[model samples]
Target: MIQQPFFTPAILLVLFAIPLALGWVPRNRFYGIRTRRALADDAAWYRINRSGAWCLIVSGLFYLAVAWVVPMSGPQDVNFRLWLLHLFAFVLPLLLGLVRIRHLSRQD
Candidate 1:
């Protein structure tokens, strides 16, 4: 695990803001790709996707926190496993974003 004494709390706080970050930032802007179609549809899609992304980020951080805080009397390997689990949380949202993009492209 990436061990940073101060990083944990800072990362956690930032992770918490992930939801609000996605919410406040426009979808088209956040997604890093622009669409050439109805404004409402794109906006709606962006909002939903952003929400999902935030959720993933936040969840991943939570897992990271747990792995650090919980002192399970297990082998050293468990720490690495926990970190990997944390990564998955963040990755899942990006995958969802890809799906969302495909869905949008399918539209007329």
Candidate 2:
């Protein structure tokens, strides 16, 4: 088993999202999705953030799983395939969250 430092950010994202996902974190400038669509109104803020939170959590878990399953001695050992998987784990959620936000924004 190899320890992947890149995966640490994914885990951190999951941790960071817990509060926002649960609504413990309010809409503010420092955290959560501060997009124009997400911050347009209270409802949009909660809805978008909630969806974003789920995306983050799911992606984070996927990243952790991949990181665990993939064999690598260190950062330098990461190959193109592993890099793509890691990128997908991080970017997929972001794209999905943006879509969700757009969808929610349209509702308003």
Candidate 3:
């Protein structure tokens, strides 16, 4: 049987974000938050992506925390909801990053 899938993805998310957060991931269309303004401008790329990466890192940690806190092994629906919660937590950073970019862009 597959063990604790939640930890795997959460760990991966944190692992992926740490590099980008550290400005290691070069701005590219294939990875990182590829906003037009961010991709076009060097300064914005680091600022925007770094901000997004931080969000992703936090999201990943939050998911880990929830998964650790909730010892739910009951109904399948509950498990499904937990997954839905994780999905929501995962995607929220993307939406937040977009909004944050708008504000951060103005600051520059």
Per-model lDDT = 0.50, 0.74, 0.71
Instruction: Encode model 2's per-residue lDDT on 1-108: one tens digit a residue.
Output: 336755668778889988888888777889997888666677778887887788778878776777677645676765878777767766786677668766766775
Q: How many residue pairs clash in each candidate?
A: 0, 0, 0
Candidates' TM-scores?
A: 0.38, 0.76, 0.69
Cα error of candidate 3 at position 32, Å: 1.1
Candidate 3 per-residue C-alpha lDDT over 65-98 given as tens digits, one digit per residue, 9 for 90 to 100: 6666653453444577666765665567546755
By lDDT, is 2 or 3 better? 2
Highest lDDT: which candidate?
A: 2
Candidate 2 segments exceeding 4 Å error: 76-78
Off by over 4 Å in 3: 74-108
Evaluate model 2: give its TM-score: 0.76
- What is every candidate's alpha-carbon RMSD to the true fold? 6.2, 2.5, 3.6
The TM-score-based order of candidates, best leading, equals: 2, 3, 1
Give me the displacement of residue 67 in model 2, in angstroms: 1.2
**Model 3 whole-model lDDT (C-alpha atoms):** 0.71
